[model samples]
Target: MEKFFHFVSQTGFSNIEVSSLVMLVIGLFLLYLGIAKKYEPLLLVPIGFGILLVNFPLSPLMVQPENGQPGGLLYYLYMGIELGIYPPLIFMGVGALTDFSPLISNPKTLLLGAAAQIGIFGTFLSMLMLGFTDLEAASIGIIGGADGPTAIYLSSQMAPHLLGAVSVAAYSYMALVPIIQPPIMRLLTTKDERRIVMEELRETTRRERILFPVIGILVTGLFLPESLPLLGMLMLGNLFRECGVVDRLSKAAQNELNNIVVIFLGLTVGAKCTASHFLTFETILILVFGLVAFAIGTATGVLMGKVMCKATGGKVNPLIGAAGVSAVPMSARVCQAVGQKENPSNFLLMFAMGPNVGGVIGSAIAAGIFLAVL
Candidate 1:
């Protein structure tokens, strides 16, 4: 009977505290969001499971081995993130799946993507003003990029201590792109701007498509070698898709490679949300700053879109500018939704894809700049 009580005491229930319970609840909520609401199920599901696993007391899956015991699975999986392997591979998958023809068709939308990065720098400066170290500021600012993998990669490099907060903030904002970006976009753009219809994208030549990936690597890598690991793999994957001879390899990258990396990346990132590291005033500040960055990114994209609209003599729809956030298809869809509300025939998805794809490159370039300068 005494041994039974001892065994029971050794389990998670006895070690669970308010903070652990809170993390568990947060994990459960993420699961509910992923499973019920279908909010970024690929991201939230594995991450939610990680949170649930780590919050349990003495969970061997998340902890280091002690007394000759084997370390937890997460402890090992985390090395991929810490060593910066996952983000580039994820980018590779992104490249494999992405269609860059829209961006090639309208190069001007690249400006909108670049404009969106103002949020990243803006938040960086703001965090500095708030007394965060330079590295911490850089990591936190990246949350505004709306690129979860990039956020995790940079945070793992610069501020591993703040990894959990910044990563969660990045992914949460990404998942909430639909809810968060529309209001900001609406507040910044007029009904006329939203209703503006865009000209159909010019068809990009197959040769242009084939050359883009190679040229992209040369230009970006020449300027920002630190970005090569990411940009190289991204372009490599895109080249696979465009090369006309590697369909099987491209499909594998898009499906198997991407899925595997996502599971590992999400679980590893979620494991960082340990109660001891996550529950703090600093974490709260990071969250607020991240939201500010996301808002600023959206606002800047729309405002830039408005400028392009006038510059193009109404040829450009300002609505597509909001897709400049690196939330990929989601941000583009938000643009479509908002535009449709104003003009039902304004099919902005193709137009928005230009900035959507450019935003991915823009954020990666920003990460490289941060890495180079600081």
Candidate 2:
């Protein structure tokens, strides 16, 4: 009876706490959302599983193993995040996959991307007002960029302790782009502004495609050397795609390599949500502020779009400005859906891509700027 009692007590059920139970439930909810709702399954699924694994009592998957036991698999996988490796690799893959022709053809839209970064800085200031330290505020602010890897990268550098909250907030908002950006977009833009159609993008010359990455690197590097690590990898990936000579490298970067890295990155990030770290008042605040940041980013982008619309004599659709949040194709797609509702014949997807890709550049630049200034 004594041995039986001891063994049973050793199990997770005996060791569980209210916080761990809550985290477990949250992890399950994430799994359901990923599996059934199809909410970013590639990311959410792995992350949800990681969260589940780490929450179990004495699970070998969490960090700093107790009692001198070896750190678990997750602890090692987390090193990629801790060492700041996965985000850059993720950026490289993004660059390989992204089609920047729209941005190249419509260069002015870059301003929309830049305008959208107001969310990052705005959130930074807001967090500071709320009494977060500079590093924590800076880490939280990057979530506004709506770029998960950038958020993770900045947090890892500035505030490693806040990684779980910031990462979850960044990715959650990114997945909810469809739900969050639309209402704000509609509320801010006129029906006519949403309905406007633009001219087709001019065919980008091979020379322009080839020169863009190189020039982008030089210009950005000169301005913000601190950003070179993330920006350099991103531009290099794009160069592989645009060079027309590295089909194998481009294919690997965008496909196989990307897939493998995402699994590691997602799982490791999720594991960071150990109940002790994630279930705090500050974590709640981070979540709330993350939403505010994204909303501000969208509003600012659309307002900039409105300005551009008037300046260009109605060539620009204010809706496309919302794509400046750097959520990649997702934000751009939201622009398309909202625009089509206003004008069924208006195909804004391609046009939206201009600011969409530009937002990626904008977010990285913002991250770099934060790294430099803070």
Candidate 3:
């Protein structure tokens, strides 16, 4: 009986054990959000599972080997993340999947995308005031751009310790865009402004389609050398799609390679969510600031859209301006859904895509600027 009691005491109820269980519940909640709510499920599900795996009592998935060398799954995943390989690879997939015709048809929306990045700078200042060092604060601030890969890339370069927090914050807020953005958007714009209609997008020529990636590459390479890895990979993927000679490669990059990398990236990001690192006051602060950053970006984009609406004689739907945060089609879809709520005949999807894609590029540019200045 004494031996049994000793065994129970030895095997049960400790802080790491309790924290691990708590973290497992958190992981399950994240999984529920992904599976049931479909909140960024592709990445979030894997991330949630990884969190569970790493936090399981005595789990070996993320721990160093007995030989005092690191050879775990998370260790390997961290290799790509640490060297900044995953984000560029992900960018390739994004570029291959993106259609740039909307931006080509309505070039003015690029300005709205640019305006949305004000949140990045704004959040950076706020973070600095909150006591983070310049580089760390800058990394946290870029989460406001609502671009996960860009946030990961910049955090990997500038403040690696903060990577997990910043990436999770960026993605979480992105998933919450439907919740966080609509209220700010509604508060800022009137009912009539929400009902504003824009002209349909004109068809872009094949020549323009072919020229865009090439020009984008050259201009980005010349002006922002720091963005080469991201912009270069993105343009390469775009060229593969537009060049008309590499359908197989483009498809593989978009589908297969993207899937594999996402799994690895998601798990690796979750591994960083170990309780000791993630369940901190700073983590809460990071999440709060990330939401703030996203809200500011959304507001700034809509305000810019309102300005353009007046200038364009109400041809621009200010709601589309809120799509300027770079979650690709997700932000654009939110804009469309909200616009349709105002008027059934409203069609803002294509117009929203301009700023949507531009937001992607704009976030990458903001990441580059953070890398350059800080």
Candidate 4:
């Protein structure tokens, strides 16, 4: 009995405690949100499961070995996240799936994307005042960009220890955009503004479509080399799609490659949520800052849209500006839904896509700026 007890104590299971149990419950809640609520399931489900696995008492999945070296599945998974491999791979898939024509047709929408980034910078300054170092605060601020991959990529580089909290915060707010953004959207715009109608988008030329990805690569590469891993891969995927010669490659990048990377990325991110790392005063602070970042981003986008609306004599729906957060089609969809609520005939989706894609590029640039400056 004594020998058996000693052996058990040497393993991870013996270390199971109340904190671990709490983490397990949190993981299950995340899983429930993903599976039942359909809240960012592609990432949340895997990450939720990973959280459960890592938090299970003495699970070897997250503990260090007797030799004092890191041990378990999570350790290995974390390597990919730490090295910053998963996000760029995900970007390649995003590039393949994204259509640039909507953006090209309404290039002026790029300003909304730029304006939305004000939240990221704003949050950075706020976090610094709250006592986080420049780099750590910058990572926290990026939650406003509303781009999960970019948030993860920048956090991995700038403040790796905060990865679990920052990533969870970024993705959670993204999933809640419909909830969080609508109230702000309604508050910021008048009913008449929401009901405004715009002309249909003009058809984009094939040459323009073909030229976009190339220009994106050159401009991003020249201006922000640090962004190339993401921008380059993203643009490459777009080129494959627009070139019209690599249907197989485009399909593979969008479907197979995307699905696989998301799984790895989600699981690895969840692994970072070990109880010791997650249950802290700092974690709570990070969550608070994340919400602020997102709110500011939404408000900035909407305000910019209002400005554009006045500038364009109501031709631009300020609500479409809120879609600039790079939550991709989701933000755009929210803009469409809200617009339809005010005016059933109003279709803002195509116009929203301009800032939607621009938001992606904007977040990447923001990440690069953080890397360069902070």
Q: All candidates: CA RMSD in angstroms?
A: 1.0, 1.3, 2.2, 1.9
Error of 2 at 13 (Å): 1.3
**What would the TM-score be for candidate 4 when compared with the true structure?**
0.95
Location of the lowest summed lDDT over 10 successive residues in candidate 3: 7-16
Write the residue-wise lDDT of candidate 3 on 236-296 in tens digits. 8988898889999999999999999999999888888888878888889898988888899
TM-score of each: 0.98, 0.97, 0.95, 0.95
Which residue pairs collide in model 1, if any? none
Residue-level lDDT tens digits of model 1 in 1-374: 99999999999888889999999999999899899988888999999888998999877787787999888899999999999999999999999999999999899999999899899999999999999999999999999889888898899999999999998899889999999999998898888888998887889999999999999999987899988888888899999999999999999899999999999999988899989999999999999999999989988998999999999899899988888887988999999999999999889999999999989998999999999999
In lDDT terms, how accurate is model 2? 0.92
Off by over 4 Å in 1: none
lDDT of 2 by residue, 50-111 (tens): 89999998787765767878878989889999999999999899999998889998899999
User: Which residue pairs collide in model 4, if any?
Assistant: 12-58, 13-58
The lDDT of each candidate is: 0.92, 0.92, 0.88, 0.89
**Alpha carbon lDDT of residue 233, candidate 2?**
87
Off by over 4 Å in 2: 65-69
Q: Residue 245 error for model 3, in Å?
A: 0.9
Candidate 3 TM-score versus the reference: 0.95
Q: Assess candidate 1 and give its lDDT.
A: 0.92
Better of 2 and 3 by lDDT: 2
Cα shift from native, residue 6, model 3 (Å): 12
